[model samples]
Target: MIKLPFTLPSRPPVTRIRKCDAAQLRAPAGPRTQPMRGFEDHFVDIVDYIVRITDEIWMERAVGRIYDTYDASCTIYSSYGVVRSVEEVIAGTITTLNAFPDGEIHHLNVAWSGDEDEGFYTSHLGHSRSTHVGRSSLGPGTGRRSSIRFAADCVSRDNRIHTEWLIRDNGAQVRQLGFDLHEVARRAAEADTLEHFIVSPETRLEGQTPRKLLDLPTDTLDGWARHMFHNIWNLKRFDWLARYYCAAATVHAGGGRVAQGVRNIGALYLNIQAAMPDGVMRVEHVCHSEENDGVIVAVRWVYEGTTAPGGVLGECPAGKQVFMMGVSHMRFSGDRIVEEWMIFDELGVLVQGYRK
Candidate 1:
């Protein structure tokens, strides 16, 4: 049984994260945060850099800009697989653009940390809308329009992105394209061309030395995030949801599904937990930024376990170990979460669980 939503009155006020607005984010170039020494002159800040480059590459049809934005040996771990080198990145982008033709990604929010010297890391939340007008890995044109949400975490230094972790709601896209999820997976498995690489926490943070924090932050958002995953997700403590979330909290879950209340949020959460009942969630990275309504927190995580019977994937347990990489952005209203946006590639997971 679910309990009534409760609040913590003794929680301290939020003050660390600086408040930002869309206008300021899209405003003319000027330094607002850390110094961007090697970055382009037009980029005001890291957020602007992320937002503009994406728009230029996707919307403006300037594919060549990738050469300037990404390093020569940049690596990208995606819902598909690991992408190495700028050439592969360029080719993939061209293929996607060719397929969609009119596809465009709108940047929703960017939660980031670090400096230009140590490399700034950004968790970018985006919404993409497009029409399948040309051929793609999914097959020939279906002439269907689809909208999905995606999250990408990128590390940048000296004006070039070095590493990135990207995940998209491929399940939602497949459904929107009017294809059977299991059928798609089976076909992909038969093709046997998919890399099936899982982006684990260690791979996401490879070769990066940890920097000591000079002054610890007072905000407990990080602690709250850990408790949500460890206790609620791992320990199956549903009763504790009310303590960390608002009664009317809304969750924009994977596959383009939205839950209106805390109960529905639990239902969505239960679906993933049930899929990998024995899976352990490992939080890879966490960052928060002040926004209009409250503080927005970004979390990158991986869930590893064997597939079980009667999960959301609509397939019985096959004893296949699956690693699900996901990213979630939570909007906190003071101490309690008011809204959450989570993105994971369910279609890819289904493919991973298939054996034929």
Candidate 2:
């Protein structure tokens, strides 16, 4: 049974539980409490607060307000190593907005784990749209447009975001930087052929990571997921998709990438292999919780490899080696996966692929 968080003053009971339909999996009602001041703790609440604080800080150009919204000791992990302080976060925000000038983030959905009293954690998936007018993360002005997707996993306590894991699509960003996607891929392939070097993460013995968060069906969904990834990415067996994914499963790769059904999912993976042959994925963090609604599994994984001939995006094999950081949030109805939302650094991959 799922119960509302007890940390905040009681919220009205969920009233009635909705039917168990994959289509009905939507954001829970409005956040438990509304943000009265700009600095109020926004991480515990749902989409509204996070989005509100984001707008106040970026759209409104109120960067200093983060000192109030984020804990003094808050730690944010991203492509760059851990951010040093709330001040750095503010600086980073300013740097990003300067490059895009009119940059705006649009959050689409949020899923959460834990509760207010202990600590509230939220997984936010969204995208950013804007014109690259000034210098941004992608480098000097290219005068290009952008529609890059990103994701955030944050935990809150006492109304301050305590920790976070942020991922963005760098591959897509590289394209927006004015380089042709195909050209980047070709460059990566040519470099790889000349160097004959590739980057990959060390694989560990399976079952090394323990499962203690929630119960699972007879199939052990958590183990099953890890196994499928091992075979598909490590063992090089894409055919395993027929068993793990439902016929109607939907695979969403944020940053303007999405595919539905097993056929499309298979094709996507195949495309990925063509681009980064011998690429391996290693799980860093895993959480699976079965609630009144259904089962949700969130896993943080990393992929590192060299670009090859069968790149997924418009890029061709450049043989440039790179590592991508990403997270996968999946929902299951009964035993099979019904839907998924995932993230990776698209721009970072391209930069590495084209590196001389």
Candidate 3:
């Protein structure tokens, strides 16, 4: 019998009694049998089973228990695709537990949808301790612990989980670990490569001159770059590339805006190129999202250059080669660029150059 956390509304109970011999009662099915439960009842049972598994048996423990019970590999998928597998999951969990033995696992909520064979489960793990702090400027602070908030779409067969698509709130977990997210995001954005960013095809001019932005082909890098700057960056020519921003395109540099524009971007790139003639800009990734008729492109970029002309940010002196990642979001119209948003690490770049 399954126990429920809450009581149901009262209903009249039938009081019936029948006399039978001890042997007959002990027999399998001499005369009568209880009605079998339906699939809905079984579905509820499965949900309860998972809840119990997560809370009572596996709470605060490593993945050993989960793996043993499910007999299946645990997998995690990011926004793009699979990031880790069950073995890695187990290793990471053990390592984490070793670092934070006093960690508490709190179940914030559980939600499920679809049938018993295919459903999604969303849960949150809170108050995880034992995070390590590194020597970076965005190191972890004291008294804070990380957490895992995740949603997993699962497929079950023969009363066991076969596969799962898990999406975790990594950003939140990182923040909980006491690392400076703004700094991390900035650095990540600056270090991104061409393969990590993307632009949508639905972006176009909202009003006049929509045709120009719409006609831009998606084939070449220059076309992409031009479309990206014109539509995405909304910054003034002289201001830091960290101002005039949007959430879609912004990176984490102390919380400011990075605008979109051609001249401004040209000046920024010129500054970088002049400082490091050997520097090469590579697109790491490009993701596209459609908004009505307009398209938004999210781009990840990496710049590799030597500080031969001295450090542009006062951190690295001349002749020092460095690599950095950054992210950008652009709105396009036809073939022309209209607006853009961007984010990256300004302080870290300067610090790196100076320290190097």
Q: Which prediction has more favorable TM-score, 1 or 2?
A: 1
Candidate 2 Cα errors over 4 Å, as ranges: 1-49, 116-118, 140-144, 180-200, 203-224, 274-276, 286-297, 305-310, 313-322, 331-335, 350-356
Q: Per-residue error at 218 for model 1, in Å?
A: 9.7
Q: Across residues 221-255, which tens digit of lDDT does each residue of candidate 1 receive?
A: 56556667777766677877887778999988887
lDDT of 3 by residue, 263-330 (tens): 44555555545555555455544444333434444455555555554333433356544544445544
Candidate 2, position 242, lDDT: 66
Clash pairs detected, candidate 1: none
- Encode model 2's per-residue lDDT on 1-356: one tens digit a residue: 43211112223222111233322322343444532333344232444456566666766778877887798877887543466478778778878878888887665545554555667566666668888888654456878888877778887766578799889876667765776655654454444422222455553458667323223232443455566567667776677686667899998874457889998998877776666675777766555434355556667777777667546644443665667678887777755678877787664465455556
Backbone N/Cα/C clashes per model: 0, 15, 76
Whole-model lDDT per candidate: 0.77, 0.63, 0.40
The RMSD of every model to the true structure, in order and in angstroms, is 7.3, 8.1, 17.5
Rank order (by TM-score, best first): 1, 2, 3
Location of the lowest summed lDDT over 10 successive residues in candidate 3:
11-20
